[model samples]
Target: MKKINLENKTILVTGAAGFIGANLVLKLLHEVSRINIVGIDNMNDYYDVGIKEWRLEEIKTKADDNSTDSSWTFIKGDIADKEMVDKIFSQYHPDIVVNLAAQAGVRYSITNPDAYIHSNLIGFYNILEACRHSGDDSGKKVEHLVYASSSSVYGGNKKVPFSTDDKVDNPVSLYAATKKSNELMAHAYSKLYNIPSTGLRFFTVYGPAGRPDMAYFGFTNKLLKGETIKIFNYGNCRRDFTYIDDIVEGIYRVMQGAPDQKNGEDGLPIPPYAVYNIGGGRPENLLDFVDILQQELLNAGVLPKDYNFEAHKELVPMQSGDVPVTYADTTALERDYGYRPSVDLRTGLRNFAEWYKKFYID
Candidate 1:
């Protein structure tokens, strides 16, 4: 693999305390020298703040390595705050901006729609504006803007393997709607302002220090506490679970391969924007996934062999904003970047189980 140079480049990563954001930040610091990273997160009580703090501690430990003066700065602020965003942009003048901050969770969006509007809508708008105008006086333009989209954008489509060309106008939940809106907004900005942007439709991302609200993490917790775990959709659903390391690698490749406008029927460059589905192409059955997870937990000493795992399993109807199955068509990603997520489900689950045992159980 050829190394892409990020030396002396200042990068801004929003939602830096989140699962994916923290992992990406650590990878960048490890790969680049003379790099300065500015991470912004509100530290909301969405999940455990302890996980966020632990992620920050990991970054700090890496930053302290004296071999490279790569500095990591954390800002406790909301991205929706225009003043704070503008101030940070002015201060850092980042060469690249990765926006991962958003109101996540499908069920949560059903009850609290306002939170999605505030963070996903308003916060994203503020970031785009800042990126557009940040270089006016400083003469340091944002080279690329990469943002997170979700597989939920596929909604209740009948398609098996979702593609970027598929119509995503029919979002099932407010969370999905906001993510689709982000892609549209990014396209418009890319067209009007000539800003290069790429939106990544991430599949079910699960790994160490994962989000507790996700089914896998939540199920683990419920099983540990001797509570019934809700197996929605009668444990018949399938998910394209992509590990965190693969996701970070995909993002790093896409960051370097920023889209460019091309001549269209109008004889002008089409918008300098693109979208890709980042997922493990393979889909695993829900029941099989749980079985593997249970075995892994027992092996890690987090669960007892005599534990009544079957008694704790409850098959329930599918909830709103949930899809039966999600698979990704990684043809474009592999063709363009020569990368594909190859982490097997069992391997990924084992890693997550080990992390959970060490972090929460021990």
Candidate 2:
């Protein structure tokens, strides 16, 4: 592995207003000094634009409060725009680039396939192109390019813990397909350009200020409105729920080390590329997860103690483009980075519930 110093480096983070992106920017500002951070996001309304704005606001507040000599510049644009991407590359000349700007959610991809293609496919291609050209004219090359890939790429695999070595050609949804394509595309670029890239296959990520479309957050919103929350696959699904902080920490560690650039026997680049799964190895049952979430909500004052939780839930068949379980085998991540997700489900949900009370109810 090639270690890249983040201090005094220019970093570009796409999806700066996103759940993970904003939090990551905050982490960097707090930890690294004299750094230049550039962010770009289209600010789409996939869930709630207000939440996205709120996350950006948090980043701004953190930047102001941070005593470190770090600077942040945000650009409102889509990565799919080749001109904008090129301009950013030329202007910022970032040493590290984190691509997290993509249309998320499986069911939404089923209905809105165009959004997936536009963002996941074309946007990723644009980023790759920019990375490819970053070394032109003796300019500083991008030391590392880290992008987000989803565990959905596992797609109905019967394995208990999905490994990076597992075949992921059978994507059940367009979103998964796009994420898989990203890995392939990054590998090709790394081989051709020696860009030193890494892809992280994130498991079910959740926590305070998370996406509302996720099951835990959505259930809370529905229960608050006295609406029935559907438990998919008759409540038999299992998920390796990873907390947002864990995810960000994984990204931060992975960013500092890029795959080693080497030469093959044939005198060609060996493609400094790798992929790892960032997840809590433990998979929790959906029913049990909901029960814990309910208790947390009550503890956080988002729900009354005497609320009839049983009446508010309905078990149903699994929806299309949905998997019965997502269990990540993070042995590679742990072995490589010496880090694993340590946040428990109950604790993560409690944090979310408290944030919900403060943001929505308070």
Candidate 3:
């Protein structure tokens, strides 16, 4: 593994306007004085495009205030388009590529499976192709390729803390299958093209300005509308809800340390590839999570102190593709990168409560 200096490097972050992508891009733009960041996103209305636009606006402001105007560039394009992806790769010649763009959500994949095939499979293949050809006829080469996977790949594993070493062959949801496929595809590309790649299996990530489709965001919206909020699996599920900032930090460190290069006895470059889970490690029950969320909302004035929380709660059966628990074994992440996502639920939920008030209520 090589330690990289962010200064004077050009990085390509797909889905730059999306939740995690936007946050990662912001950090790079403001923190690294001399780095060039090229972010590409289709800005699809998978959720509200308003939030995406808001993140982009914040990035622009950060660039302006930091006087790093030349360091940030955003392209409104879809990764599924082969020509568009090829064009961006050829034009930017980015030194590092972080692929975060994908059709996210498990339940959404039940009826809308085609979206997953287009974005997750083909889109990812296009990236692999671009990275494979990035060094062709050019002096510049992509130093690393870091892509997002999901803990959902664990599927119905009867394990406590899911480890990357565990077999993820049985994916219950289309979303999980696609994510697992991504890891396999990346491995093949890395081995054949000698591209250094790392795949991140993210847990239930939640935070301010997150995807509205997620349970946390959906629950808040429903409660605000005075509607019943469904508690899936009869409130028996537990999740390792990781915060966005901690996820970004984990990604930043992983980017700097690509898997060590290896060669076979025949001297052919063997792909240096690795995978790890990024999560809080502490699994919080859904009911307890909601309790904290309610308190935080009250504390932040997003909800009235006298709001009838019990009236809005509705326990329901587990939907298809749902699991009982998702606990991450983050030992590898901590051992390799010296970082672990340990943000307490209360602190994280409080931050979301405050942000929710400012964004929607205020």
The C-alpha lDDT values of all candidates are 0.90, 0.95, 0.92
RMSD in angstroms between candidate 2 and the native structure over all alpha carbons: 0.7
lDDT of 3 by residue, 176-268 (tens): 999999999999988998889999999998899999999989999999999999999999999999999999999998888888778989998
Residues 314-338, candidate 2, lDDT per residue (tens digit)? 9999999999999999999989998
Residue pairs in clash, model 3: none
Q: Which ten residues in a row are the worst by lDDT in model 2?
A: 134-143
- Per-residue lDDT over 101-153 for candidate 1, one digit per residue giving the tens place of the 0 to 100 score: 99999999999999999999999999999988978989888888999999999
Sort every candidate by lDDT, greatest first: 2, 3, 1
Candidate 1: segments with Cα more than 4 A from true spot: 1-4, 261-269
